[model samples]
Target: MTNQNILAVDDATDRPRISVIGTGYLGATHAAAMAEMGFDVVGVDQDPRKVEALSAGRVPFFEPGLPELIEKHVATGRLRFTTDIAEATAVSDVHFICVGTPQQATSFAANLSYVEDATAAVAKNLTHPGLIVGKSTVPVGTAARLRLLVARHVPAGVGVELIWNPEFLREGKAVDDTLSPDRIVLGGASPAAEATMRELYALPIAAGAPVITCDLPTAELVKVSANAFLATKISFINAIAEVCEAAGADVSVLADALGHDVRIGRQFLNAGLGFGGGCLPKDIRALMHRSKELGAHQAAGLMQQVDEINMAQRQSVIDKTVVAAGGSVLNKRIGVLGVAFKPFTDDVRDSPALNVAAALHLRGAQVTVHDPEANGTARANFPTLSYASNPLDAAIGASALLVLTEWPELVDVSPESLGEIVENRVVIDARNCLDPERWAAAGWRVVSLGKETVVPAPAVRVAALV
Candidate 1:
């Protein structure tokens, strides 16, 4: 009754009530950000434990600035979490579906069951007409299907209008990306739905983010296309690294020179273990699966190559080690630095570095691994592998060291110092993370992915000979 008074009296100051379904990284952030924007946000997820945790102002995962945002919003009573879909639908004027579309267990296809179920719940619970927007990365035609899904259900007086507003949030920077996005893409079945979205996103648009409107398919494609392009760029450079290795050139310099071209500006073009994480690998596979279902099998075939190239980077590193170790890791002591798929993220889904380290272990190398935040996850995934606290600890007593994930600490590690730790002087820069000249000057051997190795400097070479 008291709540009715504030909204009933001041429509001008009223932000539209919004419900965000799902409480994964994306939903949690979205719900919090909406609350930060002065909207009352009800976050819904089937995971009652997650709902409880979030309702108590706890973030399940680490993102740089998310915990503060969640705390601020939850303290204000503007954000809440629940497993109850009906209550959320009744209380909110808009619904956002932000469920995870994980890759299917046995196929390249995405298991869209979570997304479809969320949509159905929204449709069933609606007793008043409201706009239900999808903030999930879904297949192109999924928006149309969801619209039909919603229209078929809900109360007689209620109608569900579908809107597609695909989230382009990067994992580590999701909060910033959501509130201050570079651009916003909104698409739907009707002009009215698009207009409603425009109104909803007006805050960010007014703050200078471009809001682009297109068809539902285009919005969906925007997310997958961006990931695909990034994955392709990484694989492209990694492929170039393979060529550079054969030709005796440095991929770092090559990437630098080629990046000078405006069309191919330097971004995700680092020649390393290629791309891996929750998003890129899964989305690309899902897109390929969808493309085949759409009868565009030929068009989707290159993704196989893309994936093959990416996977091959891991094997290539192991092979390089095999080459360095004289064709066998039978008694090699290999230290691996960094295990996250990428740095600054705790997520280890499809982490290439971890995979490489495990493979090396399985092939008989004594693999020691280290990562700032991903160590626990890596250990959980591969308990047999040894973990060290830092770079020096990982390198100490090792026959060879490999820089797998490019953590900032590894970038600044003094090779001269590392030379003192390893039993053998060999170091492999799997992420092309080391300075060859620095290592060469430090009396240690260095190898970079997609590039040739640098032999030990004069004094170290003489010592090895002696």
Candidate 2:
């Protein structure tokens, strides 16, 4: 069937009305972007609090530029939030499932119950011909299973087609990524669905975003595979970082030289606290779990090692902090900077920086943490640890300061000023973001990963002439 027949709507422009299910990070961004593209968008979620917040032009989480965009659309009346699935299905022509498929509590495999529930809800609530788009990252073959589930749930004689259009959003740049993605992937899209999607994404396509159309399984694999490859690249450099430290070489310099090679781009080559957040860690583990299930043993093992190396970097940071704190952190004042996983967003899920701080606190250190945008979120995650609003406050009376996340605010702090307040002028640059010379010149000892520690030379005592 042609998209015109499937997407019958009252608007004179005939644009497909959009309903994004599950208004977390992915869904909220997508719904707002669709509205920006001149499509009336409704975001559906079971959480009344989330709906109310979005309706009031307030975002529940921190993502750069998302709040302003949401506020603009909300004011223009092109976007809205609702908790009623039936109302959304009745009004919208395209339903996008952007729910979370987080790692299972007991296993590494993805917990797909949310995706299943969202799909079933959309399928059962259909009042007219509509298209279902899957934007959540899932295990391969999940699309086919969901297709069957949709078929069983939708009312008879209703035309409902499902497609997978995986989302690749960085936490900090989610707004820009959604509005102008690097590429668009459409999986298992029938000609009708593809046509509708092409029209729906007319803006990005016009602005030169490449689109790839493929079968369902390939589309499902694309998201996880991309995440896995990025995670592998990070782990690869971090593995080399261990070697760099042992060989008395610098990994940051090594990574710079390696990045000069076009084949190995320098994007994820930073050998620091490795990678953490909502996506990379869980996605890699889920990929490994799925690979093993599919009997791809070698692939699974590689991912296992990648995960191990990434996690090991966290312990490396904690160990370095202990050494910087005079062999132990017991009752020592440890100041931590940057808690959000990578920075620019207030998401602390599995944040390496926060992890290190919590570990230090557990070891009897008095921990004070700070972040540009994530202090509140970090406090929620690790409440027992003390939090400071600014970097200097975190450094007050600290025995050792650790820069975990590479936020510019933390990286660009004046070492001389920090020196005056810190009890012991020891700083561990776990992210390799701080300048060792600057800190050392300011009478501070700088310990960085993948490099030798830099310490200020002791002053010689002058003998009085008799």
Candidate 3:
């Protein structure tokens, strides 16, 4: 059948009415994208404020192009939001559990309470035969455990099947990732459950995104494994970056040479402040914790190193900044550019930029931060630090500047323009995104990760003999 026909049938029978639980980054984007794909989508969350904002076509957080998508679908009546889980279960035939699985406060393990609670709520309220798909990043074997928990609450003879369909959306490119994903993965117990998922992702699959179907545990492993590999790749380059720093070799040049090998392919090869934000850090730690629980201590040891290397990059920035300030930032003014974990989003969870900024602040530096999109979020997370409206504002009267997150404006900023504002001419390119030559020509001392700062020749002093 044609795509048009599929939507018509769905609307006629109300067969694929979709409900998304936990309207955070992943859930909100999925709900809006599903609505845009012509499904009647109801986004359910425990926070009434979030539901109200989403219902009014406003995205609570920043993701480029998401608010527009949400606004368009809300106007067309294809999308809505509510805090009512009962209302959601009553109307929707497919429930997507998109709740978060944050790392526990005191441990490396993932706190599965959110996932379990979301599953239990759906199971208790699933009044009709439907599919419960999990799109959250979770530990391996979580799907098998949830299946048993869900089965007990679901009514006998009512087909409420749990499926593992983990999400791989990047923060900045979430919309594109959801609409035209690199691939789709679905894990289910039976053919019927897989069939439901296939139909649900038919649009993307038709758009040339391949689908991988497997059993529950394998499916759960895919998301965490991908994150682990990416984190390892980042840390590997960073580990090499440390070597380059010690040897005075340029990591950027090394990464370029390494990129030529087709097998390596240079995606996450850039050595900088290292990987942070919601996914990589917590996911890898959770994987390590799960590996230990499963008696795979050797595997966990490697991941533990990955975590350590990632975190060490942040401290490296702190150490470099202190060195740039001549061993102390005691009452020195410092400018910081970019506080988001990465560009194009306002998520600051485990952000290296903020961590570095906070460390500097604690060291008695008057730190002024500027992020094109993350100032509000960063302010909430680190209220003691000062914030600026723009990079120039952040630079004004600062003894030194640190480029933390590589937002485009910060990357393209003219060193001359920034030089005109600061008290001293010093910059630390923590992200390795700036041009060393350009900053040096502008008469700034540029410090970069994995590269040494070159001191310019001293001006000849001619003593006049009277």
Give the winner by TM-score.
2
Candidate 1 lDDT at 417 equals 87
Best model per lDDT: 2
Q: Kindly report which residue stretches of model 1 are placed more than 4 angstroms away from their true locations once superposed.
A: 1-13, 189-191, 460-466
Better of 2 and 3 by lDDT: 2
Cα deviation in Å at residue 380, candidate 1? 2.2
Scanning candidate 1 in windows of ten residues, the lowest lDDT window is 1-10
Ranking by TM-score: 2, 3, 1
Candidate-wise lDDT, in order? 0.83, 0.92, 0.89
- How does each model score on TM-score? 0.92, 0.97, 0.95
Could you give candidate 1's per-residue lDDT for residues 262-290 as a string of tens digits?
99998877898778889999988988888
Tens digits of per-residue lDDT for model 2, 136-233: 98999999999899988988778888999999988889989999999999998888789899999999999999999999999999999999999999
- For 1-466, candidate 3 gives per-residue lDDT tens digits of 0111212223554548899999999999999899877789999999999889998999999999999999999999989999889899888888999999999999999999999999999888866677788999999888889888987888665667788888999999999999989999988646666666677788988989998888888989999999999999999999999999999899999999999999997889999999889999999999999999999998799999999998999998899888888899999999999999999999999999999999999999999999999999999989999999989999998888999999988999989999998888899899899988878888888888888884444567999999
Runs of candidate 2 with Cα error greater than 4 angstroms are 1-5, 10-13, 457-466
**lDDT, candidate 2, at 230:** 97
Where does candidate 3 stray beyond 4 Å? Answer: 1-15, 456-466
Worst 10 residues of 3 by lDDT: 1-10
